[model samples]
Target: MNIASRPTAATPPPNALITEAVQLIEEAGPLDDAAAMREAMARRTDLPGRIALRAQLLGQRLGLQHELARARQWAPWIGLGLVLAIVLAGLGLAGSVVGGAERRINIMAALVSLLGLHLLTLLAWLLGLLLPLRAPRLSFGWLWMTLTARVAGGRQGQAPVLMRAATRLLARARLLPWALGLVSHGIWTLSFLVVLAALLFALAFHRYTLNWETTILDPQFFLQAVQWLGRLPAVFGFATPDAGVVLAPGGMADAAGQRSWALWLTGCIVVYGLLPRMLLLLLSVAMWQWRRRGLQPALDAPCHRRLAARFEALAPRAIVDADPGAEHPPAPARPLDTGDALLAVGFELPPDVAWPPAGLPADARALRIDGSAEARRTLLDTAAQLRPRALLLACRAAASPDRGTERLLRELLAHCGDCGLWLLAEDGGAALPETGVQRWRDWLRDCGLERIAVHARLGDALAGG
Candidate 1:
């Protein structure tokens, strides 16, 4: 498969697009530096016009890894629905059973079977929200992601770069557990409704009495509880038994009473079990939508930052050269000593300039320092350890000498006492202004360092020295 081929004009779904992009980035290898990768992406002429550059990159990669695209699109929903159907069937059959030809359901037992675990799970979910606890692993969302990872062979091998990218995107969207919970709760509501339907079907073909018996509770307690529970269902025109009916010693065995009891049970399931879960499902859906709209890949992440810088460098921008100075005299040609290690520090060189430019001696080692504080610290530490015989500091000639530059020079001088200091001026394809060159020279002299030699390139300095 042509992994580098651009995707056709038709755009896939967003999730699919993202998945593809991640695959492409991984296929391209380590993106610690994205300059070459971006270049490769830009050269792809066949990428769809409608998709953004980021999406296009992914799609191209997806096109390459075609073998891994055989996920069962309908499996998650079908599996969940089948499980709900099984639970409903089991519960309905269990509730329909009778003993000694009495054919009566223990009201308390039936209610507990229907609502006990649901109520407990709801309470636990609520507590999870209030308390500092990790997300539940048993959630539908967790299961779905795990299943997807397994199907995609994500866990069996090293995690690809795109997988990490996808994770970051989801995290930024802030819809991990909540989105999963929504699916789970929606399934729970459906399961309860299915059970209710099954119960109604069972009632059509068979006759059963509903009764409550408790050793610890009096008849009045049961009557009051029934009245309280029946209030909501009563408003919807479902029948509720009065004091005489609740207090009856033989229980409600007549057809009308049985009908009333069935309506009351269905009402309780709808109002308590199904209704709240459905509401939670809706809430999660809304939250996921709200958060998804704000989804954007974090630009400051290292890989993304490098990609952004690369794109920025590619854009056309006018170069304003403040230095028009006569070029410094070329240093006399001399081969670099075999034992001297070359420590080269670049102070914002142009993107095109390669560090430790190709001609250095075999023994030389190089480090490139950018604007990051941490990188500067690393540079200092590395320099301390290497203690090279020569120190080559390279900076753009167009950049004005600032106090930060002064401080850096002071620190390096202090650390690498009396070493050969070469200030390599990179003109960035333009001549440096005479004033800029003198400014840097004057600054170095003020630091009590007079023997410093200036060169336009490291190769020239190495050749001269």
Candidate 2:
């Protein structure tokens, strides 16, 4: 199905399937037991009653994972607020140190300290992405999750696990990292804006001269760099001092020159530092939203596949033999002295196997039992009512004999005495696993059934009977 057409977390109904699934997960405690989860979903009549049960369930799971993450980090905004405060305080402190000095502030040094550090951070982030594996410590989001996990321990601690599992399930979606990058860069962008605001405020009230002093690098190089930086903002009609004025720098010659230098510095910070960060933030957000729109769980995963099968099995259908062999002709019906003599039943039969083999008496009845509570109850009730003289229970060899099978057998045996148990193996039993056959034998033996028959083919079993 096209996941993009489906409702997302951004736009959902009041009683969304995902919200319901999150409640179920919370009530489930540890989120184990796939059967119980399926049962819970099956019981919900409010859910969209449709053929896409698997897709709906998966979408709900995604929603539940998101809810868990949000709950675990209950106050993420608090962390963001703290970060903003720290940025403002740091910028304010730097501004104080710059404006407090009697000597002129080195505009080049201030720009490098502010914008260069951010550029280096951006480069580090890019390099980390290129590496196949990254340390957890390198991830700002991971650190945030870790800190929040510690605060909300135990049951709440499952958020990280859920998040990791969701990421793996939706790895092809590629939304998580982009979403995280958007937030990280957004914070940086905001920080720069706050720093710019502080710088502007300092420039307005305090009279500070702008100078450039570097021993190793020639002044010409610094002048050229400033001129280059000013060019972008100059396009927007901001003042870009001439090469002569930039090169003649010890300190600004006059108040007008100092004002012009301030404008140039402000323009450079806005153009170089703020604008690039803002663009990256917007790009990350766009990518994140695009990926989120297409996010879908891996429906082919074993757990989801089994759940889908379970849902499909709930649909009622006629009990008919799926596989019939052409090798054996129908045996002539042998009249039985007793009425309602033999009833053949197949339990969780594979699609390839036939039911009620041709060799059975013409009067013999056939039934197929699926893996459902209602089906099991119906089978038991039908057996009690019919009370066939001899019963034949057939099961596929590929199906592992579980406690549910044993329970059904016990119940059936209680209703019909002296029943014949048949294990129908695929491919004339040649491809049947020895261990699977032995396992069934062992289970039957434990149930005190001594005459269990293993048949490679339905025709052979019927002919033998």
Candidate 3:
């Protein structure tokens, strides 16, 4: 059973991996870019928080929320409609066994009619899970999604992103089978139950005789088929017709024989049809819940990554100061109660770029940033706690600047008394391409950090050169 509709895909990526406890990423509406800039610079949340909120706002601004809400509202109805249709289909199959004018039930024909379609669909569902398969859009679950999409104004704006993100998310978590199977089995379970009810009603209320009919098969074959099909049902306490009833000519059976045949058919439907479908429905529910506990969006998707980068430009401190100051912002004399004399953090750097850049002071604390939410949070927390005298944020010179980087710069700058951007390269790093240096210079200026030194080497940055 669905406890709720789908949760947000852009929840704050976990400190380690995504977990259910993560809060819903807030959806936002249109706002002035300037206002967003001021808000971001003043904001205290981490990178993931900022990105999630910004992406949500951007989506709403583009009118995704209305469409998304409509889709979600219709999701359950589509699912329920499929279930209702299954029940009607099964009832129709059961009714096919009832003779309009004759007073006999063709036992074999009735059995095939009730179970044939169910078995075929069940087999197809199994094959889908066994192979390296994506859940087809035509399947009941996806049909619901598609129909709901149409009801919600079709796949426009961020709607497609949500759809692709959901597939990628569930498929990556290996829950596609469990999810699709849940719906599949639910449909079959209800259908089989309906068929069973109809068969019981006809059996109890009508006086029709029950017997097998075959044009080419031997009497021995009918005897064997009944015995084989009835073994398991008999084990479950169902009455099975004996050879006297099965081998009789013209499919004629006495009252007792007819009774036996009736129970046998009911037992077959219950044991093979209803029981298996219900059990599978339960299993799919359990597996889906188990596999999907901590499910989060796979960030590798270009759409989700793009949403995250949407606010890369409007950092909280991307706000500029009214008056200019000296080129170098002076360092704090020292930490008041406690903190590193110098805190050097390595932002996403290549493996070749040496970590904890050499020549840190005795009281310096060195940390490496691997680009995970946890790593970023740890650095931010440490900086806030230590109140470091100087923060030397070392980034690679070759790395292209993005809004995320600028936001990170602003947040890091806010925590420490003095903060500077250090462009790491081997010797003669500062003398590299003029374009690269100037680009970074522009990036820093845009972050309102122009006065902060952009050092080319460890020594020069430390020495205030």
Candidate 4:
């Protein structure tokens, strides 16, 4: 993580081993400044005392991805679980019962049955919500807060341990709402499904229950339930009910009497209509939680760690100044501050999904680059106008020149040094043109250019042509 050793005007080395080393450093992830430096360190062969640095860094990334994915996957379930608990609590408090008259389950009994479920759901959601706060390896919030603290606190001294711990706590606290939201959502969905299933089962079982007084049998009880669902919206003023059409549940009657359709209708409407709206409400709340709390702020958001690595590769000397000590008077109070040691990895745009340029280009910049020599010049000129120290060039794999493209390569290589160049071939199929491959290699060697890092769009090859 020594930023002071970077070269000021470095070029990619000709050796494949050296080039691979540099690319690894620049491409390392975790999206932090200090992490970027470690990635950069992976390029240095002469650094002693650390043998497994590369493996350790790679392992860290793999582990983080696993942890993050797991966390994300659990988010929805946690939300749903909380929602279910709330629903159960409501039912218990309301003393809601299931089934028709004469065959109905006791309201108190239903509530008692749901109490165990409520407690378990509560425990599960609370554990999930709090796990991020306690887990050290998954402390993204801590990392971001510390980065912000460093930026705000100045770079003159090392960060205090207390401050670091405090930031971690702050990060954990920040994520609590998101976790709770997810739990709430999970609980609601669970409860809704449970109620819907129970109601369906009850309706099915009760449809043919014989009344001693009634001789008639109804065949469309399930169908009537569906119709009740259609009528539910009208219950809430969605549509006016026709006058004199009020439907009310009637108790069982004597044999040869009309069947009780109202009872069946009530269960169906409540299950299909009311439950769905309640579930939607929970989903909306969860979405709001996601938008407000889970999403990282723009400044505190993660950036590509590779940018710093690429910068270090193109101009290592620019970053590493042997004079960090030389600038200040030697004093007990004064200490060299690395100040977060973050680097902007190369600029990473969202990946381009299209291939063959389709009708328009996949990327406007790419279209301009592969269009003509003048277009390339125009792009370079525009970039120069912006005074950017580096430019990331994305070219189609198929568009990469072959034997016939030697002249293009020579031309591109000749002018690429004006600003640090990052030539990105979007497709893995893009090969060095055959005639120019050896020449390009030699030229790269002569100019000390390192390996060109390849970024393949996974599944892009399989996309519709």
Q: Give the top-scoring candidate (lDDT).
A: 3
Higher lDDT: candidate 2 or 4? Answer: 2
Residue 336 CA displacement from its true place in model 4, Å: 55
User: How would you order the candidates by lDDT, starting with the best?
Assistant: 3, 2, 1, 4
Error of 3 at 98 (Å): 2.4
Tens digits of per-residue lDDT, candidate 3, 1-465, equal: 010121333453222121111111222333344444345435734444544444444445545556567667877888898889888888788787874468678889889888887777777777777888667544566666666656666644445545554555567678877777787778878888788888888888898878777779887888898999999999999999998888877767798888898999999999988898789889988987687754664433333333323333333233223234534343224335445467888887655456665577766788888767788889889888877778888875545566556556667766666677777542213334334355577756655566567866677678772
Query: In model 3, which regions exceed 4 Å deviation?
Result: 1-44, 155-161, 300-465
By TM-score, how accurate is candidate 2? 0.56
For all predicted structures, in order, the TM-scores are 0.54, 0.56, 0.62, 0.29
Which candidate's TM-score is highest?
A: 3
Task: Give the alpha carbon lDDT tens digit for every residue of 303-354 in model 1.
Answer: 4434433343333332223234523333223323323466767656655566
Q: After superposition, how far is residue 460 of candidate 2 from its true place, in Å?
A: 12
Candidate 3 global lDDT: 0.65
- For candidate 1, the lDDT comes to 0.57
Segments in model 2 whose C-alpha atoms lie over 4 Å from true places? 1-38, 44-73, 93-97, 126-143, 154-156, 306-465
* Candidate 1 pairs with clashing backbones: 20-58, 21-58, 22-162, 323-432, 323-433, 324-433, 324-434, 325-433, 325-434, 334-464
Per-residue lDDT over 1-465 for candidate 2, one digit per residue giving the tens place of the 0 to 100 score: 111223433313222334334333444454443654465456643123321343345445555445555644664764576466649765864575366658477877777777776677676666655564442244444455455544443464445544454444334465555655665677778788788888887788877878777789977797788888888999877797666667764765577777777788888878877888798789888887676644544333333333433443342321123223423222223223323556788787655456655556688788987778998898888877876656787765534455566567666655554466566544213334334455555546654554445544455455543
lDDT of candidate model 4 versus the reference: 0.35
The candidate, 1 or 3, that scores higher on lDDT is 3
Candidate 4, residues 84-184, lDDT tens digits: the string is 55566554433344434555443224333544444454455446555754423222222333443344334542222223333333243364334333334
CA lDDT of each prediction against the hidden true structure: 0.57, 0.58, 0.65, 0.35
